[model samples]
Target: MEENNLIKKCQRGDKEAFQKLISQYHPIVHKFLVKITNHEQTAEDLTQETFLKIIRNIEKFDIEGKAKFSTYVITIAKNAYIDYLRREKRAMQNTPIPENLNIEDVHIQVEETVVNKLYGQSILENLEGLSEEQKIAIKLKYIEGLTLKEIGDQLNLETKTVKSRIHNGIVRLRKQLEKGDER
Candidate 1:
């Protein structure tokens, strides 16, 4: 297969092969990063980091009987995004509170946390009625903001399947919400 040949060439340190691979998957990975980070610059930076990791660990990549190369690369991208989030969380937590900061800032943070918690709980309660696949598709597409193709890559489904799952899941959620409103 062409993918197998590319993987072999990449493992053998063929920069052209590696470049080809990156060019092919960069959009998918960058789209995924944008969903996670919600910032174009951060997503771009993370995209580069993901490829660097892939280049460094190409030899460890198993092309046959393991996983598709796209899936493997997406996994790497997701892990990199998660690591970035964790680092950001830690940085925020370690940031010192300025003595001159207004009380309104603290109050705003508290309010935001409360709103997020309530919104998250409402979504989770509604999701309880969905099948696992539906729930995952909805979460990845709506909550994570991944495109259909990116979701397909992550879930190992075709883009059409991902679109169907997301559409059906949204319909179900809408019905559930309407029923709740009737009560």
Candidate 2:
């Protein structure tokens, strides 16, 4: 099911829609909890607690907001784990919960990371028209983190030529992306 539709159905209090939404995000929430708690059983318990809180508070989530549903789930999962830590009194036997889980700074970092990844993917998809030389040069410099001299040496070209290829490739990419934005 489409995520927006699922969210809308969930907002309208459909039990089945909430189940589907949980199915979509359960693995991510579980994985994140596992990382924080370092135990499958604890992660599972926290995951359930997270969703229960979701059931109680899902109505307050703004479907039209910039935050993605996954981000919301993760933030809730973190909060659940934090609550677990506090309730169990940190001295709880061998619990691996990190001492430094900061809920205050979680949301912006997750949102920015998602945005950067999707933005980078869009740029990569628009690499169709670049020449083979330009593509290799750009990738070696940007993706592979090679200097111009190193890229030139690898490609058996002069450093100036490598730099020019990368520069022109970026200019063309920029123009194409800008034109795309107009539509």
Candidate 3:
């Protein structure tokens, strides 16, 4: 059976159907968690938690104009991961930095950690350099997950104009990334 149909069955309180649906989606959910968490065991635990929440809250889900099953599951997984990060950050903040740890080693680790973040920031800065309409259009269409038509509606632009903005923004962002790589 299709996942959507299986999800509908599960939502209707069929235990066997829910179990089957969970089994099908478990690997996908785990892989996504692993990518974000970078820990296999933690990913497995989070994946289980995600499915448990889904099963518990499935009744609240409306099929009408709702996001796809995978998108909904991913949003839940992303939220759970963000919550985990917040807790981890709080715990770390409560701990004192060890004075005995070599400053050079800490610096090296920080550099490695920040390079990717810097790359992303550079791309964002380039996007911000675009015309206001282009930047807003791209952000609505890509970051906000709006369709081209939706972006057009929100921006009071033609669909083609929205598409052009997104296309131009993506091209500029790519160029920025490329220039940074050359550096």
Candidate 4:
């Protein structure tokens, strides 16, 4: 069956269609979650949660929108991972830190921030030479975690145009990084 037909059937509460859809998109969601979480078990659990959310709320999906099904699913997976992080943070905050751990031991946190800032600064410097469109596309796709269609909508451009800009921007960044390495 066509994807649209499958989606329609799933939306109508057809369990078989929903299962097929989940099977089709599960790997994509799992891979994306793994990238974000860096843990196989967490990614697997999140992937299942994403599909569950989709199954429960499939009626909310807009079939005629510019966003593709995969994009929508990926967005859900990203949001799910973010929610997990927030929950983890809240849990950590509620738990008391051990008295054996001194304030001096927390220097690792400051060092991590400094390292992140240095990398961020380097990336910003490399991005300076890119065209405005390229820069915006790259930032929206990677930093802001927006889909290509979402970025296109924001920039009033086509999806292909946004994708091209991101591709060109990445190439330029790679060349810049290589030059920096050589220096």
Q: 2 or 4: which has the higher lDDT?
A: 4
Give the clashing pairs for model 3: none
Tens-digit lDDT string for candidate 4 (54-80) = 999999988887677877887788678
Reference-based lDDT, each prediction: 0.82, 0.76, 0.73, 0.80
Tens-place lDDT per residue, model 3, 1-183, is 276677788888999998887887888778667754557888888898888899999977776644667667776776676677668779989999787999899899879756855766665657646665566566556555778986555444589988987788788778877886786
Angstrom error at residue 145, model 2: 20
RMSD of 2: 19.9
* TM-scores of all candidate predictions against the true structure: 0.64, 0.48, 0.53, 0.58
Q: Which sequence of candidate numbers ranks them by lDDT, best first?
A: 1, 4, 2, 3
- Tens digits of per-residue lDDT for model 2, 1-183: 278888788888999999888887898778666654657999999999989988888888887886667667766776676677667775666578677978766888777756764677557756646765676578668765779986665455689999999999999999987876675
The model with the greater TM-score, 2 or 4, is 4
**Which stretches of model 2 miss by more than 4 angstroms?**
90-183
Tens digits of per-residue lDDT for model 1, 10-90: 999999999999999999889877765557999899999999999999999877665788789888887787687669879
For model 2 the TM-score comes to 0.48
